[model samples]
Target: MSQFALLGQRRFAPFFWTQALAAFNDNAFRCALLVLVAFQLGLDDHAAAIYTNLAPALFILPFFLFSASAGQLAEKIEKTRIIRWVKWFEIAAMVIAAVGFVMHHVSLLLVVLFMMGLHSTVFGPIKYAILPQALKSAELVGGNGLVEMGTQLAILLGMIVGTTTMGAAEIGPWLAACITIGVAVVGYLACRAIPAAPATAPELKFNPNTFGETARVIRITHADRAVWNAVLGISWFWFFGTVLIAQLPIYTRETLGGDNTVYTLVLTLFTIGSGIGALACEKLSGKRVEIGLVPLGAFGLTAFGVDLYFARHGVAPVRGLGWLGFLRGAGSWRIALDLMLIGAFAGLYVVPLFAFVQARAPREKLSRIIAGNNIMNAVLIVAAAGFGLGMGALGFSAAEIFFAAALLNILVAGYIFTLVPEFILHFFTWTLANTLYRVRADGLRHIPEEGPALLVCNHVSFVDPLLLMANLRRPARFVMYYRIFNIPLLKFLFKTAKAIPIAGQKEDPAVLQQAWDAVDAALADGELVCIFPEGALTRDGAIAPFRPGVEKILARRPVPVVPMALRGLWGSMWSRRDSALGRARLPRRFRARVELVVDAPVSPEHARAAALEARVRELRGDMA
Candidate 1:
């Protein structure tokens, strides 16, 4: 089923709406305040600028101060209770905001903004930490996609409504107040429908010190390099977004020389593109948490950003054109497409990273880790603002700033991917496996989600390890024949993947011994290890004799043994079937059909090498 089916389910729908509405309410309040400060506050330009700019910082400040505490609370208390309380706090904040609006009290309204920020900080952990508990592993990416799409659209709507309502001449403040309060109440009602989310760590004592807790949570987030990089990736996205969004209004008015309508049109295109891209994650990823998409997104961001800079490079100013008129203007369509694609790529870039962080973080500390992510995000957002201001101070135009940000994106992406090669590695493996053949994997659920297991598959071809690695959800450490393991172009990947290489006893006794030692160590560390029971590739398209190396490994540490087989690879280019440079193997069947068939795992005590060989042969059947 498509991920949209989640929107209709009780388990997800209400929480989704509650979160989306909260986003809507936040934008509504913030935009309303900005409108008031700009048009009605009657302050000097300097003072007005201070309030307008400082408003966002006030909102973000809470994330820096209270996110650590909020994360811990989500871990200690049932999440639904927190959601309900947060909703109540939202209502209270809105009420205070209403009085601020009616009485023209800027100070009261600023406090209201800070309270709303506090509300969001408390909800941030619950928002992400709840997903892993609610959805299956396969659904994590799609679920996040839907949430992201909803949030993007909600923010758009709230910004439009908040500005429209508050900017009206008659009863504007009261209308904004009513709208905010109504959304808050409806959000609370939605929270009632959210199912109970039990505490992930109930026994953990509270850390009353925010600074110490912040340090501790950040340490936990840093414990895993991949997760920490994922957090950085997320933070970079916020920085990217904040810079672009902050520039859009000025870009619209100063560069395009268009009025409010044109500004709204560009923002709409960007936000809608983001929502569409978010929804596309499910189909693009084939329902997996595919981090490779992050690279694709980064590429798009850089490419389109440069294109956008050029699209509007030297346009002369035009006055008060509607969105349609702007479209009719020279180079406008290209500019429009550029903005939309940037937003879409932003969606592609961020959704999977969020899902990966959710999937990989330890359950007990998931909330705290999310809090760490928030702190990082806040810091990056501040940096983005400073960067943009620094660029503007250098007298760069908005288009130049866009170009600079785009170029900076390359450096940022390069740094992150370098820090963690798994993304690029996954990109390579995903591309190669998807390109070479159509692989069908059966009984993948037979592999355990956690802990050590021994996978025994009949050796098929030189690329069997790659196929298995791509298809398996949990990572596997492969034990391969030393020659194939050292294949020149692939040797680097093998070592990076930590594959164990071995040779026949006569060829290399030391290598064989090291292979066994590695297998035992992997299992002891609770990692999956896969070995070919038939140690050599079939010479005549038949299963080779079972090797006793597997039996030896299992003897050292008894673990679950899963038997599997690769089918339809006998005549592939990588296979040894018709060995005249393998040209005879290359006809008609290019991108051939291949299958990795897995069977139920057996206990190590019952899993002899011969038994696994027989099982794999049975699974392979007549495919060869």
Candidate 2:
């Protein structure tokens, strides 16, 4: 089903709107406050800047102070109930904001700003933790993409609506306040329909001390190295984006030489571009939590960020230019493109990381982990602010900062990639599968979400392992013939993947025994393992008799055995058909349609070599 289809489901649709409206209201209130400070409060430039900047800091402060407690609340209470409470809190906050708007009470409004921040801080963990319960594993990427897109669009429109309504001459402040309050009310109604999300850890202890809880929760997240790095990756995106957003006003005036309208236009490009990129993730990732795109996103972020600096540096002067005038000016389109692409890449960089956190973090502690991520994000955001200030203090222009920030991304990404080679390996496998074959996986859901399983497939080509690796959601260790395992270019890959290399018992008993030991150990530790029952690539485009190797392994360590068949690969480049010297050769099918049909897993007792071979044959059905 299309990712947009989620908009119609009661379980998801209501929650999506509730979340989207929350974002809309948050931005609306924030923009309204900034507008009041800027044009109506009678403050000097220095004073206006202080309020403008301080507002965001106040909004973000709750994330650091209250996130840990909020996460505990989410884990201890039903998510829908908390969402309702949060929505009600938003309504109360907006009501106070209305009074502030009328009296121009900066202090009252600042208090309301902090309250709104508190509302978000409390809702943060509930919002993310509920998705895994609500959506299937396959729906996660699509679901997250939709949420991310909605948030970006909401932010863009909220800023426009709030600022515009507040600044209007005849119906100022009052109308904006009404809209914000109305949105909050509607958001509360939306929360009422969010299907009850059960508390993941109802028995867990609660810590009222935010500081202690914060450190403990952060430790929980950091305990998993992969997840912690993913959190850092997310934090880095915020830092990168925070810097760009902070510089937009200055970039408009000094770099683009444009007025307020041009500034709005540029921000709109970025927001819309991010939405598009987010919506595209489901299709690009094939509905999986594909982290390969993370690297691709990092590449785009650095590439376009640097390009934006150059685009700004060579910008043609367009004094006092409005939106239309800026668009018509030289180098303007390039600048717009750079901003949009950068935002697009930011979406790419973040969606999967969010999904990975949801899927990987322990269910009981997922909310606390999300809270920890929020803390990290807030820290990075503050660091970004400091970086911006330091750059400005050092006399660096906005464009120069952009250039330097882009360069810094390379080092950060390199470090993250070094910490997580799975991301790069996934990219290679994902790209190779998509490029070389139009691959379809049938019955992928048969693979257990978490457990040991022995996969027995009809081996057709040298790249069958790669195909299976790419298609399977869980990683599986493959046992391969030593020659294919030791192929010069593939040796590093085989070793890195921890593929077991084996020789016949008569030739090398030591290698054979080690391979058996490794397979048993992997299964003991609850890992998936795959072996071709045929034992070697088919010399002809026909099925080979099943070997007893699978039977031997099953006898030693019994596990559920899944029978898989690879069809339509007989004519592919990796296949031995019509080849000289039995080497892989290219075929007309550059992107040949290949199907890996996985049958339902049978218990170990029922998965004898003869039975599995018969099952695979039936599935393959004379595809050759």
Candidate 3:
């Protein structure tokens, strides 16, 4: 089903609107305040700058101070109740904001700014934590994509509406006040319909000391190296976005020589592209939380970012061009395409990371981990602001800053990928598998979502492991013949996947023993291990005798055993079918139709090699 279907479901629709409206109100109020200070208040430039600068700092301060507490609250209290309270808090803030707007009370508006920030700080944990509970494993990525799409569009609309509403002649302030409060109230009503998401750690002790709790949460977040790096990757995304967005206004004015209409057009293009990309995740990922897209996203962000600098780096000769006028000018299309792709890639980058964190983190501690992510995001956003200012201070053009950020993305992505090679490994396998074949996987649910499982599959081709890796919802370690595992070109991928390399007892008894020990250890540690019981690929398109290795491994670990089969691969590239002189033939057809069929998992006691081979043969049928 399309991810959009979730929007029509009671489980998702209400919460979606509540969060979207809150985003709208947050941006609308902030933009209205900016319009007031910059254009309406008639304050001098220096005074206006003070208020403008103070606003973000004040808003971000709450995240640094209260995120830990908010995380704890989300963990201890039922999520819907907290969300309702947060919505009420937003209404109260808007009430104060309404007064502040009518009286032109800068101090009061700033206070409301901080209040909205606090509101977001409190809502942040629940926003993510609730999703995993509400969504099935299949729905997690789609759900996150929907939320992200809503947020981007909401933020864009809010900015446009707020700016336009507040820019009106006389009724602007009152209108802005009315709109924010109304949105807040509607958000509260929407949130009331959100289904209850019970706390994950209700029986756990709550930590009240902000500093101590913050430290503890951070430590917990960092406990998993992959999760921690995902958090850092997320932070880097915020940093990149902050710099890109902060420069857009100036970029529109000085570089593009466009007025506000053009600015809005560019912003709209970016946001819409992001929405499209976010909504595409479920389709592209095959309804799975596929991290392979992260590398793809990182690549696009850097590529377009550099291209954006070159598309139009210098100041435009014409000034005050309207939206249509800007489009009519030279190179405008390139600039627009670059911005749109940048946003699209950003969507691809972030949604998976969020889902990965949700799927991988300990359920009970997930809220606190999300809080830690928020704290890191805030730090990077602040740093990005500083980066923009410093670059501008050094007389760098907006385009130069873009160039610098793109280059920095390369370094950042490299560092993160190095720290977690699984991302790169997944990317390689995902790309290879998707390019080589159209895969239809059935009965993936038979593999347990968590804990140890032994997967036995018929060996079909050289890329069997990659195919399975790409299709399996959960990660699994492959046990492969040592020669294949040590293939020079594929060595890195095999090592990163932690594939156990086995040798025949006659060829290398030591390696065989080590492989046996590794398989047992991995199972003991609660991980999935997949092995091909055929021992060698069949030269003919027929079932081969099942080796006794699977039985031996079961004897050691006794994990649940799942039988799997790969169909339509016997004649594909890298299979032995068309081989001559000990080499396989090139692919005769691109994107061959392939299917991974998994049967119900068998108990270890019943999962003998002959039985698994019979089941796999039954599953494969005459397809091979």
Report the number of the highest-TM-score candidate: 3
lDDT of 3 by residue, 1-624 (tens): 778899999899999999999999999999999999999888999999999999999999999999999999999999999999999999999999999999999999999999999999999999999999988898999999999999999999999999999999999999999999999999999998999999899997888899999999899999999999999999999999999999999999999999999999989999998887788888888888899999999999999999999999998788999999999888899999999999999999999999999999999999999999999999999999999999999999888999999999999999999999989988988899889899999998798989999999999888899999999999999999999888898888799999999999999999999999999999999999999888888888898999998889989889899999999999776889867656667777889899999989999999888888889999999999
- Clash count for each candidate, listed in order shown: 0, 0, 0
Candidate 3 Cα errors over 4 Å, as ranges:
580-582
Give lDDT tens digits, candidate 1, residues 222-298. 99999999999999999999999998888888788788999899999999999988888777776777887899899
TM-score of 3: 0.98
Q: Model 1: how far is 579 from its true place, Å?
A: 1.0
The count of residue-pair clashes in candidate 3 stands at 0
Local distance difference test, per candidate? 0.90, 0.90, 0.93
Across residues 1-624, which tens digit of lDDT does each residue of candidate 2 receive?
898999999879999999999999999999999999999978999999899889989999999999999999999998998999899899999999999998889999999999999999998998899999999888899999999999999998899999899998856789888999999999999889989999999998899888999999999999998899999999999999899988888888888888889889989999988988888888887777888889989999999999988776634455678999888877778989998998898888899899989988889999999999999999999999999989989989889888888999999998998888877777788889889998888898898888899999998988899888877877789999987788998787887677989889887899999999999999998999999889888878788999998888889999999999999998677888767666656678568889999999999998888998899999999785
lDDT of 1: 0.90
Candidate 2 yields a Cα-based lDDT of 0.90
- Give the Å error, residue 62, model 1: 0.6
lDDT rank, highest first? 3, 1, 2
